[model samples]
Structure formats: C-alpha cells, structure tokens
Target chain A: MITLHDIGFSYGNNHVLHDITTDFHPGEIVGIIGPSGAGKTTLLRILLGELTPTQGRINNSSSANIAVGYVPQLDSGERTFPLTVEEMVLLGAAAFSRKKPWFDQSEKREASRILERLGILQLRNNRLSELSGGQFQRALIARALMSRPSLLLLDEPTSGIDLHTRQQVLDLVHELQTDGFTIILTTHDLNWVAAQLPRILCLNGTVTGDGAPSEVLTSQVVRETYGANMDVIFHQGRPVVVDSVNNGGNQ
Target chain B: MSYFTDPFQYDFFSRALIVSVLIGALAGAIGPFVLVRRMAYIGQGMSQSILGGVALGVVWGLDLYFGAAVAAGLSAALIYFVRNRGVPVDTAIGIVASTLFAIGVAVVSSSRDRRLNSANLLFGNVLGVDTEDIILVALVTVIAAIVLFRNYKTLLAVTHNSAVAAAHGVRARLMEVIFSALLAMVVVTALRVLGVLLVAATLLIPAATATMTFRTFRNITIASICLGTSFAIIGLFLSFHRNIASGPAIVLVGATVFAMNMLTSTTSQRNRA
Candidate 1:
C-alpha cells in the first residue's frame, strides 16, 4: 500500500498541495483527474521521490525495493537522436546492472520478451524518430514495464493518441493490474477515467473527493475541478463529461 | 625527400604523429556522448577555463597539465554546485569561466618578460611533443576508450533519459559525476597538442561533422575518429609547410569538413523528400 499522510508542498512561497491525506492500495488502478496546474504531476513526483513533500511522510510497500517505473509525457524523441525502438526499450533494464559492464544474455532475453509481449517485436529495429503517436505511447508503456516495478506512474499516457489506441493502452493497464501491478495515472480524459477506473480521486490542490467513480464524480466536484457550467452526462453506458461553455465539446 | 625516407626517422615527428592519432581517437570515441548529453557547451566552457590554470602554472613554474586539470575540475564542480544551488548552469559557466579566462589574458599580456610563452600555449607547437608525454596521452586515451566501450549501453541509457535510468536502478547522479570527471580528463590530455583555445574543437567539430552524415551511433563514432585524425595530420603538415599556427590550421580544416558534410546531408535529405 502507498499512503500519504498530511502531505504538503510549496514552491518558494506558493503552496501547491496542502495537507493531502490519502491511501493508494495495491491491485487497483487509481485515476487522478484535475484541471491544468492542479498539482497532479506534483503528486506523482512526490510518490516517485523526484520531489519531497514539505511537511509529511509517505509509506510505500515494505518489500517494494525496485524503483517506480515512470512514463513521462515528454520524451527525447522531440530532439534529434537516431535511437531504435529496441534500443529505447533496453533503457528500461539499464538500471539492472551493478558493475562489470555489459548486459548478459538473460537481461537481453527479458528485454526482447517485453517487446514481444507489447506486440512490437516487428518494430524492434525501427528508429524511435519514426514511430507514430499511438505506437510511441505503447512503446513508452512497454519501456516502463521493463523494470517490473510494483507501482507504475504515468503522466498523460494518452494525451495525443487517437481514441481507439487510448482504449487499448488503458486495457493494457488493466491487464497489468490483473498481474498485480498498481497503476497510478493522471489523464485529461475524465470520461475514460470514470468508465474504466474503479477508484477516482478528484483533485484541486488537495483531494476534493475520493470513492468509486460514480459516487465521487458529482456535479459540484466536476465543476470545481474543471471549470464552471460543465455538465456530467451518462450516455451510451458511459459517463461523458461535457463543457457546455465550449459549445458541446470536451475542450 | 630524405625526411620522407622513414616517417619515424625523426623521433619528434613520430611522437607528434602518434600522439595526434591517439588524441584524435580519444576525442572521436568519447565525443558523441558529449554531443548527445548536451554537454558540448559545457565542454567549451571547461576548455576555456583551462587557460586560466595554464597561465597560473606557467607563472608559478608548476606542471601545466596538472594545473589545467585542476582548473577544469574545479570549474566543472562549480558549474554543478551552482546548478544545485538553483542557478542556471550556462549562466554560472558564463560568469565564472569568462572572468577566469579574462584574468588569464590579462596575466599573459602583462608578463611578457617573465620568459613565459603564451603564443606557444595558444597555437600549440606539436614539434615539442616528447616521448614521455606522447606515451602518457596514449595510455590515458586507451584506458578511457576501453571504459567507454565496455559501458556503452549504460551510458546511453543515462544520456537518453536520466529519470527512466534512475527508475530502472541506475545511479544517474553518480554516473553523471563520473562522466564529468572523465570529460575533464579527456580535455586536459587533448590540450597537449590542440592547446587550450582549440582543444574543444578537437572534441566537438569531428563528432558534429560525422553526425551530419551518419544515422547510427557506432558509425558516427568511427567517422568522427577518422575525420579528427585526418584533420590533425593534414593540419600538422599545413602548419609545417606554410609556417602557420597548428591550432588555427587544424580548426579551419575541421570547420571546412563539417560545412561540407552539412551541405551534402541537407541536399541529400531534400532530394529524398
């Protein structure tokens, strides 16, 4: 279990997260939904130990020794580097070495296995500069899973992908959950989060509400986290978040 | 023609040639990491900072390479410390290195009568390379190259993504510190022939030139080494024949080769498109 007790964070003088008390249990995919600049990334960073809380403690699983795998939204692909997909995925196992250089045969086998599992073994030799948005997202997730960490923290894994691939990525997360991995993700797709995630954390600086998606995604919480005049509609057996101010669109 | 009878007939020229090749190999092999890590600017900054150390060592009658190494190390540490202190690294490098470099210029200008030759340090008289120094350069370069080749994948991971590397259990910060130290070592050794002002070019130009044409990491490294060594040999010849400065001549040749590579790659890319 991951527990944050009285967690507070500040940048210089601006208090970003104030007294956040929450518990994230294992074998569950928890989705954090919030507006921009609402400390979602900061909360992830705190859990990943990139940023320490100013006034609280975090309790992780006692036996969880491996570092938390992170899927950053931004990648070095935006820069010009002729790295291949297999090369990129191999980076996930880079930390598995202690000394004496080079990865042995077993490590190489494990990396190839991950590539096969992700259904991208055919694209192993393809350069990362050539992958499509959805393909890149899948590759990033595969890279994250290479470490076999207990907790997977993703930051907007579906930000720029098409809807179909987004569902596939979420399905992949659910499958990993079935394999007993805990996924803590932040996404702008609240409807998908509402539909797929068992537990939802509505956040604005602090946790506004926390429960099952149907119970916590109330009209007041939606408007407070998102903007004003937002409507929550249940259509086609799914909760669709509509911002009427934006003229019947999610934006 | 008698001088061409046997290339190693003159021990000085042989030492210079061997040292140049070894230094070129060193720079070529390690340079892509510098290019990829976005530490090219910092390498330039550190090389310039070596001028101050060289000047001080000359004035005090101390070992020049030792002085240069210390100064470069201190400058690198200072850059990291300033960054850790919330100051931007480039700004700190600009402030600290430029001030120190300026001080070196002032000292060199005022102490013309102290029997210290600043021009020799700037342009580099490769004819003065002795057997001991050449052997030292070769040994250091070989060792460094071996380490780099052995740990190529781990270092690549660190360069690609420090966060992911750290997550996968790589000691990212420790690896970074080791990289910086090795860079300082490489720069100091390279300054033996290229001199303080032009050493960074020895490291950067050939790697960048190869990058314009090559897509694979391994091929880029090999091409850079070949180009760097070729430039050094040609530059040495041009300096000897025309009685010009070796350092400037080498850099000019490197710059020309780089421009040509850039032109060919751009035109080829356009044609493909």
Candidate 2:
C-alpha cells in the first residue's frame, strides 16, 4: 500500500497540486481522469519519485526498495530509434543490473517471457518502427513488465489507437489487474475510464472526486472536471457517458 | 598500382597514414553517440571554437593543441550550462560557436606572429604531422575507447531517453557531462588531421551513412568505423595523386560515400516496399 498525505506541489510560484491525500492498496486498478493541464502527468511524476511534493509526505507499506514501472507517453523520436522489440525490453532488465553490461541468459529469458505474456513474442525481433499502434503499446507494456514491478503506471496508453485496439488494451489491463498487480493509468477518455476502471480519480489540479466509477462520475462532477456538459446514463448495469454535443436523444 | 604503393615508400606518408587511420577510427566510434543524441552540431561548435584557443596559444607562445583543447572544453561546458538555463540547445550552440569563432578570427588578425599559420590550422596538412602528435592522438583514442566501452549501456540509455534513464537510477546528467568532455577531447585531437572546418564532417558523415544502411546500433557502429577508415585511406591516396589538400579530400570522400549509401538504401527500401 502507498499513501499520499496533504500533497502539494508548486513550480516556482505556480501551484499545481494542492492539499491532496490518497491511499492506494495492493491489487487496485485506478484511473486518473482529467482535462489538459489538470496535473495528471505531474501527479504521476511525483508518485514515481521524479518530483518531490513541497508540502506533503508519502508512506509506503511495502518493504524497502519497491520497484515502480512506468510507461511514458509515446514519443515520435522513439519510432526512429534503432532498437528491436527484444532489445527495447532488455533495456528494462539492464537498468537493474548496473554492474553487468551484458544481459545474461536469465535476463534474456525474462524478457522473452514478458513478451510472450504480452502476446507480442512474435514481434520480439521486429524493429520498433515496424510495429502498429496496438503492437507498439503492447511492446511498451512488455518493457515495463520486464522489471516485475510492484506498481505499474501508464500515461495515455490508448490515445492514438483505434476503438478496437483501445478495447483490446483495456482488456489486457483487466487481465493484469486480475493477476493482483497494482495499476494506475491516466487518460482523457472519460467513457472508457468509466466503463473499465474499478475506481476513478477525477482531477482538476486537485482530487475533485475519488470513488467507484458510478458514485464519482456524476454529471455535475464530470462538468466540474472537464468544463463541458456530459450526460451519464446506465446501460446493462454499467455507466456510459455521452458528450452533450453528440447526445442525439440522451438529453 | 604505383598510385597507392608509392606514397607508402616515404616515412612521412606512412606516419600520416597511420595517424589518419587512428583518428578516423576514433571519430567513427564516437559518431553514433553524437548523431543519436542530436549533438552533431555540438561537434561543429567545439571544433570551430578550437581556433580561438589555437590563436590564444600562439599569442602566448604555448602549445596550440593545449589552447585548442582548453577552448573546446570551455565552449562545450558553456553550451551545456546554457542549455540547463532553458535556452533551446541549437540556439545556445549557435550563439557560443559564432561568438568564439569571431574571437578567434579577431585574435589571429591582430597578432603580429608570423609563425602562426591560420590557414594550416583551418585546413590541416596531414603530411606535416609529427610523431609526438601521433602519440598524443593514440593516447587520447585509447582512453576514450575505454571510457565509452565501460559506460556503453548507461550511455545508450541516456542517449535513447534521458528521462526514462533517470527514473531507472542512471545519473543522466553526469553521463551527459562526461560525454561532452570526451567529445571536446575528440574534437581537439582530430584537429591535427581533419582541421577545424572539416572535423565535424568526419564525426557526422560516417555515422549518418551507417545509419542509412544498417538497422541495428551495433551494426551501424561497426559500419561507421569501416567507412571512416576507408574514406581516410582513399582520401589520402587521392590527395597524394591529385595534389589537393588532404583535409578537404578526406571530407569529400566521406561525403561521396554518404551520398552513395543514401542512394542504395533508398532504392533497397523502395524494393522492399
């Protein structure tokens, strides 16, 4: 379990996060939803220990030296980088073994296993530029899993993919959650987060709402966080969000 | 043919050949990092700045190589410092490079020393290389190879993505500084054969050509070394036969190879598609 208490962060004179307190238990799958400039990435960076809060403390119940895995946003430059999928995954293992410059057999085995688990083992020898959007996301996830991290944080995992690919990625996330791995992801897709994640944190520079999807994703809270009117409805016992502009008859 | 074998008969030609091979290999080895990290222009900046240092050394009756090394190191550090201040890297490099180059020109123009031949420094005369210069180049090359080999993985991580590397416990900033210093040393040592103007070409063209032809980092690096050395030898022979300046000949040979590689790779890619 990881707990953040009264977390506040300021860059120079501009405060980004303020007086936030939250606790994340093991095996929890949480989605952080917000508009642009909502400090979602900033919050993730702080949790990854890349940035320190100016006015808060964190408590971790896990043992010392907990490994945190992160899949950053896709960079266009990474497409041109001359690394095969296997080599990219091997970089994760390389980070742990600082003393050995070469990856041992066991490390290679681990990378292969992770690629297999991610259903991308066939692409292990393919260059990154050759992978499609969905395959590329899977490769990045495999790279993150190579560390066998206790906590996994993914930033915008389904941003540029098609709807079918998005659903497949969400299904993969569900499978990972079933394996008792704690996962936190940030996304702007409100409907997807509403339907997929067990818990949602609605953030607009601070934690505006935090609870189960049904309880926290009310029309008023969605409006407050996104600054746009959205209609929330229940279909087959699951909540679905429709944007006001696109809601033909839901209004 | 005697065209190539005749130059090998002279001791100076043999020595110059050896030095060219060594410098070419060093530049080739360091080229990938420069291209991968987008520091190709930094080589231009540091090499050009070496002129100011050379001029300063001449005015003070010091070893010109020493002055060039110090000046290049300072310029590299200044570029690093400016980048940290939120200035875009290319702008910082451009500002520092032009300023230092102007200073070097001013110093040369005002100096009354007759022995300091600016033309020789700008366009190198590889035939005039001495044994001491060859020794210095060899020592620097060995040291650079060892450092790069020892930190190969860390440096790769940093070059690919610095933020991710930092998150994984690698000291990206320290590696960057050390790499910059090493690059400065390379530029300074290479000035003897490639000269200030063309040194950046030696550092850039080989890696770029390799990148066009290869798909893996290791293969690209190996290809770069081979191409660099080949260009050096071919350029030496061409210069010896045609009575052209050695530095321009080497760079022209490299440019030719780059163009040829570009053409072949594009055609192959089209064929694959």
Query: Could you say which candidate leads in lDDT?
Result: 2
**Chain B TM per candidate, please?**
0.90, 0.94
Deviation of model 2 at A56, angstroms:
1.2
Evaluate fnat for each of the predicted models and list the values in order.
0.50, 0.29
lDDT of 1 at A30: 92
lDDT by residue (tens digit), candidate 2, A165-229: 99989999989889888999999988889888889999987898999998888888887887777
Give the alpha carbon lDDT tens digit for every residue of B1-273 in model 2: 898799988887777788888888888988888998777788998899888888888899898789998898888878879999999999999988888888888988888787456676777777668898889888998898788777767777778777666666667788887788778877888777778888889988999999887777767778888988899899888878887777898999999989988898889889999
Highest TM-score: give the candidate number: 2
Worst ten in a row by lDDT for model 1 chain B: B1-10
lDDT of 1 by residue, A1-251 (tens): 88899999999898889879999887788999898888999998888887889989988767655358888885644335666777677678776654444566786687788888877888877777778777787778777887778889899887887889888888888888998888999988888899888998888898888888777876778877775557777876566667665555443
DockQ score for candidate 1: 0.49
lDDT score of residue B53 within candidate 2: 87
Best prediction by DockQ: 1
Q: What TM-score would you give candidate 2 relative to the actual structure? A: 0.93
Clashing pairs in 2: none
